[model samples]
Target: MRDEQDDGRGAALAELRGRLAASVAVARLNRTQLAARAGLGRTTVSEALSPNGPVPSAETVAALAGVLKLPPGELLALHRTASAPHVVGDEGTVTADGPGRAIEGYSPHDLEVHPAGPGRIASGCGGVGGAQELPGYVSRGHDRVLAGAVSDAAAGRSGIVVLVGTSSTGKTRACWEAVQPLADRGWRLWHPFDPTRAQAALEDLHRVTPRTVVWLNEAQHYLGDRAFGERIASAVHQLLVSPERGPVLVLGTLWPEYAHRYTVLPAPGSDDLHSRVRELLSGRTLPVPDAFDSQALAAAAALAENGDLLLADALTRARDDGRVTQDLAGAPELLNRYHNPRTPAAKALLEAAMDARRLGVGPHLPPAFLTDAAIDYLGQTDYDQLTDDWAETAYAELAEPVHGKQAPLRRTTPRPSRRSPAPAIAPQAESRLRLADYLEQHGRTARRHLCPPASFWHAAHTHLTHPDDLNNLAQAAESRHRLQWAHHLRHRAADLGNTAALYRQAEHRDAAGDQEGAEALLREAADLGNISALYRLAVMRERAGDRDGAAVLARRA
Candidate 1:
């Protein structure tokens, strides 16, 4: 009987191995390439593929399956089958008997709730002191819409509710509050984030059952992948339309830029990059305003009267413009820290992060980049006064969370591989940091007209990887009439396959009377599927009296 059991397990292992090998072949990745991409050692990859090897660990299988574009859930199931001992009367069927079994991804009850703010401390009579625990949820206009949608989901109508707003505008808080009742009703909340946003969604979205809340906080991460965003959007649309998947509420939050990108229609003859995303988002978005209006503020004041000191303080401290959400998010506290940093080095570090963010750099700022850029904010006297470990001390101070909530600069863990579940291979000695959302937004206004110094431009050129950011900096440089910097940065962005940068570079070349250079760039952009570039080339051809070439280009466009 033991021997028969061993044979069954071996067969399962062999089946898993065969599936993995086939998937690798289809993906056209050898063991070495697969290992490198998956952030796993080559030896691990080889052993997992060996026919006679033991069942791979769950993480190993997930990493490989993610790299191969196979469903990690299905692959992990196979791994479990091979590893788990077969019990009599135990079948492979999963039943919705409890929270553990019912949830496909993460259980709503298991999620760590974000702090609302400091509650009223126990004081004499109506005295409000320091914050104690989380404050009461102050009702807002969007909350009403969110509640109605949640109610609809409870009543067997699955729908998506996307809250669109800027940073620190309480979009996430609203979504978190909306899904609370679902947890009590045995509804599962699946927030896919293990391997990668797009990969995790593609792998597990199909299996999302009814009465589940698909939490897509920062929805751009899931729907911004050029390769898979449309596919994920299609899957989401399918999830909504399928009658068998009733009572599933797909909730998402998005910044305005991301919302615009997904919803805005392209011009005629241009590629429709976000058609599926538009379809998925059509008529389902609820705009969460950045500031509370008078009516909302009045309601919050009512809540403040009920001993919610956080609300009371926010009401007292809120500017005339009504930045109550930012106050609640410790935005003022973050700014205070920035203004009154313990040391000049710390202040310089904060300034560097703020400048980088305002200049359109991505959220994750490397320590090295910050260190390199911060020097430009300091004078030679200040720089000479710095200790050997000044950078370390400064980062530690700024990265500390204020009010037990937001920080001036928050440390970020190394992200998992884009193609696999495993954490990407990165140096362990230093961590990346991101400026607080509130600071990033504030700096955009405060530093809008300020061009970064030479050191900033140099450090960004050395450390920045995203083409969009490079293009943005290039545009900034061009606006400041720093032509040399603009030319180099724009060229780098174009080289990185940014078609928009290619179009912009062509325009710059044309403006400089370098018609040949412009035409060459336009041709490259047109080949890379930029319809604007094709149209521009058509115009150029017509101007050059190549009527036949012009006609062909126009027709192609």
Candidate 2:
């Protein structure tokens, strides 16, 4: 029975291969051409059609069927012998339909039809997932807050919406949902949600698309550094009111002072915040007592570790001098000096920090709650050391609980206190110190060592392990001095399974005289979904013999 089944399967496979070969021939395209379109190499096409061809992968079959303009089901069915019964195992089975399969694209109708489940909730920063519903926006008290903010912005005829709340308060979820309509309306919207990733992307956006709606979530952290903040603010202003690219509707969620300083929108009402919080917790049962207090306690704990009284005095002096809290980015140093000297100001800052840690200030409090002086003073010293101390204190506090109890350590991660940085130094001096600073902070060497005189080619070769570097190398290879180095780097990197480098390596090989090697490299890259590699492989396959195989691969490429 097994032999019969195997033979039937083999015969079916042979029949399908013959039919596919005939179809390619009838199409009047060579194997290489087909391979080029299909994104496969000549050899790959040849192997697939060979008498001892391996069982096709689902992805490969889909690629081939897509290129051949044939139903994957039809081709798959043709591979089953008439004498053998088709059996689907217990594993999840894929059913392929006829040709001309309808492709799914971005559509509002489709989005609406798709079930909107309780969305994956997350906050912009330190907070983890919140209760299913948000506390304010759609909730009674929170609804008022959302409505007030939205209404104020709407009344002012602002094109943007700003939702502000503390961490884990569902600000991210609210903003994400609120912006869906913008996307549906075909408006390009961007967010600076992830600092490390978004900064690079935003730089690209500034270079390319000038006027784009930017929804900045947690705008404070990114703009916390005065220079950095000012640069970003300047960019925002240009996007908003520039003649060349003006009026990019900007909505941002931030602390009150930061919002007022950076945004054109009005503040959201208190009713909205309360209603939203209530609504988010409506369906669910949680210990709602002291919810706000708990957050305050967390904040206070953070404050006590680093902030002191001297910082508060410096902050007051700066404020009295008519400096905006946004500009008070540098007042911490004065506070730090006074506090360390056992001055009355230092005593006051410590008292405030202790109060902040114990009593917890509500979100409704002014930015003065986390004063510029306190933030700066805290930032000047090692918060990490303070954190280490805090962690130790917490561990000791919790140690007594498990002493006589059978329970293991709860494995809780303490909340990190958010502290601002020290005052900025001169730009030129800062730039000169950056390398040493980075090495000291991160314990790593800077990439500047890769290239002397900073040639694109040199930098590319040194960072060949990076795909972007390989791309840079490829582009630089067009220049006389960089060609050999680029090719060499790409060739080495390709061997390490870097797809971009592999594609570049194939190009270099083709430019050199190794057609076969180039074709092979392209095939490998194509299999990994490198479109350029697939395109190259198809061309190479056609040049080599096997017109039928080339035609199939070309379609796929």
Candidate 3:
């Protein structure tokens, strides 16, 4: 029997490793290259291939599948060969005649992974680990939030209570700890994204033995960007507020930075959709300990259950160096180390990301924008391969797809709001269209993969004949979250006597606290028939107590 089991496990590993080896070969990737694409370290991939290397976790396998363009199901199948059933708390024994078969552990209606990229696919998100208690699974303030969430679910009083914090703060483990106590009380996790599963769960509530818990961790994908994402939100809402509720608890977690983006609407105030989303996310939002030390590191190792062994080692090193501070103050430094940029391409990518963050755009640094920065700093290279593999060194928690080809993401860019009655979308679309046309006609650059206008930076340097083209390019830069790039283009346009560009540059300068520079631009813009610039100049003149000049300029209105 033991030989049979070993033989089965060996065959599974061999097959899975075979597939992985084939993918790397087909892509012509070395250890470093393969690691970068799979979002793992070169060492992790190396170990998986080595004879003595430990079995890779499901998350590792899944990430490789995503980067290799292999089927996720195959990795999941491979995971089953190595994965032992996660034991929740203590194994429970069934009554002699209750089910006719002996069962161990309080089975919480048997929770399954969600289809929408469970585990690391959704950026460190997961359903219950079935209390497998993967290493590094720490419970901070566990009793406070988990107990409350479970109680609410049992009583049907709470609609949704999220464990909101920055990434890797042990939010998921806190939740599992809370739910484990109630496993025998009829609390099963139900994923409502599938239409069929959703309907069945909603209809068959009476037949449910324990209550149901809809674990909605790192669910920004469903709420923020795609239309289908909203469906998941709606289904969760139905379960939450369902008139026929029977102890069905809705719990979730989110990065606080994304709260407004997902909860609020672009249209302002409160609309039905916004209200619904807001309500779905309402309830007790418990804060995790958010501390990292000896305990946290151990918890992380345990939580990973597998693939995270390499990461655990890295964290241990960081901890030993005294670099891993108590909280996120040392995050950037730790991130830099974790990125471990050995190659020029990898170093450049890390620098670009760190630069953006230093410049205050790193929090919202989209993958495409990072690619833009990389090309600007490193010249042209194969970023598609780099980002797929090793970008995780810098972007440890990329909640969204790195390719940015998933769907129209909800951008948090500041735009001209609805006061103008003309939607911001139309003007933005026109600007992009105009820029695309200019790039194709003059530069002869055809855009593909919706890649950035790589030549736009060069165009910004050159003297363009048309003012509209310059201003349009500026807007495109701003839309891409490259504020400095936008300012540079606007300054260039202003030099060419674009009045609107002059005003825009003036605003930029003023916001940047270069008041004298702003005043100079405003003076130029006023001469070019910009009324707002004149008004700004008048205000400045008044502050300097040139009352007569202020009156004259103000009368010009």
Candidate 4:
């Protein structure tokens, strides 16, 4: 008996043959001429363009659009429809008729990867020796999703599951665990969600064997992008509702921000195609949770010790800023300990040390500056060395305060107390007080050797009062690959009316991947008569293919 899949596909080909003949006539060409334009042999084009029983190859269909001047996308849709066993039904639905041979363009090689364990997940990278290896998967915060998918697949229902989360969150692990139980039950796994090849890959998945699990990992570019999202959403809708398209489950993951981007509706109260998918997936959608369980907590603790991003050098070490809290879980029940200085001299010196530590680390402060800041802090607090308060009488017993500059900075991080905050935010450059003053006040050698707390520059754009010092410091930090510190000082200098600072700030921002911010700063500096900024804009315009704009900028420069 002829298979129903073959019959439905035959019907589709009959329709395609008629369309192909019409397209040829529209292009005013016979098979020979069409074959010449398409760069295929006359016989090959004849066989593919035939309106009878034989189906055309996808590549041939792809060629026809350019040869016949038909829209490429329209021909692609037709190719996708005719090549897949899931026959396109009325109104663009994929309905399965019966089992048939896999569609053309679908690579069936290596369809199954041996499972390491029952719940193991495959992360394409980041293994022990950097070799690809399956690891036991943790389905953290996705219990409901895993259960729903397992229940639905076991019941022979086909639908889409979208797992949304931020970067490095375990969306892949969760979905792998969701489909693990089905893997042993003869369901084949396929990935149809590659960002660069998303729409094209979907055509391949459409032709795969029935009872397959389609993984659309990180599919935000396809489903969330404004330009291509609607077409993808329509494709997904058909994949879900078409009964003829056998029992296949679609698994996908995306960032939450991308997910929300597609929530826009087409009209008032009417959901758009992307929104429609969310409606279809009503209860099955899963978002990665911020909360953690005991097992997750243990795993996170382990990762904290061994795992880190590429910026390993940027990481700050743990700082013990004099406050002490202890929890020795295995110790005696009544055991307790307190941390504090025992002597008056120790207390005074320790307080000053804490103040010094509060200063920034990248631009280390010299001993002279730290000594001044510390002594100033002590004086403001009325910390006298005598009788626990500094007085003229105690000066005889205690030697004159020596600077910490002689010793390398053992600590650079300081804690924020209720009374004081770090110099994370500073005031205007024209303020009466100045943070860069601390970095200044000394000759070039002292300025070069010491780092100042951010607060030193904050609450005042010392650049207004100390432009020469800031320019030197910013350049030094930039040369050391400390772009962040350099950018901070340049920002203050720019606020202090330094047009050169604006251009430098833009350059640093561009290096740090803030192109828009950099461009904005560049424009500001260009308007402020910075020739370097104008030259950079000209180079940028030339690279962006705005030749006329580049010429204009170059002329201005």
- Candidate 3, lDDT over the whole model: 0.51
Candidate 2 per-residue lDDT over residues 356-426, each given as its tens digit: 22221211111122222232333334443354244334223322221112111122232334455744432
lDDT of 3 at 176: 54
Mark the 10 consecutive residues where model 1 has the least summed lDDT: 91-100
Tens-digit lDDT string for candidate 3 (1-557): 44565666667778888888898789887888878877666666786767666566555677788878889897678756643221122222111111111112323223321111111222223333432223333444544657766776656563567777655554554565576655656445544343233232322222222255665556564455343345555556655554444345666666777776656556755444545566666545666544555665666556445665434433543445322222212232233332444444544544444433322231333444454455554545645445555544433332222111111112333344466665653223211101111111112212221324444355333534346656766776687776776777777777789888988877778889898998998988888788998898899889888989988998886
Q: Which scores higher on lDDT, 3 or 4?
A: 3
Stretches of candidate 3 above 4 Å error? 1-133, 152-159, 192-210, 225-238, 241-244, 264-273, 293-557
Question: How much lDDT does each candidate structure score?
Answer: 0.76, 0.41, 0.51, 0.51
Tell me the spans in candidate 1 whose CA falls farther than 4 Å from its real position.
Answer: 1-133, 332-557
The TM-score, computed over Cα atoms with residue i paired to residue i, of candidate 3 is 0.33
RMSD of 2: 37.5
Write the residue-wise lDDT of candidate 4 on 1-557 in tens digits: 23666665666676666777898888788888988888665765787766642455455676776777667676667566666664353332334432222222122112222222112233443223322233333346576766687678656677778877664345565665576577556456666543344544433444544566766676775666555555556666676676656567777777777677655456787745576555644665678753345665454345435652111111111012200000101011111100122333333332333333332222333333333333333443354543534322222222221121111122222322344554453432221211121112121333345444444333123322444445555665566666676777666667766777877778878899887788889998888778898899899888878999999999999
Prediction-by-prediction clash tally: 0, 55, 22, 20
Q: At residue 352, what lDDT does model 2 achieve?
A: 29
C-alpha TM-score for every candidate: 0.49, 0.24, 0.33, 0.42
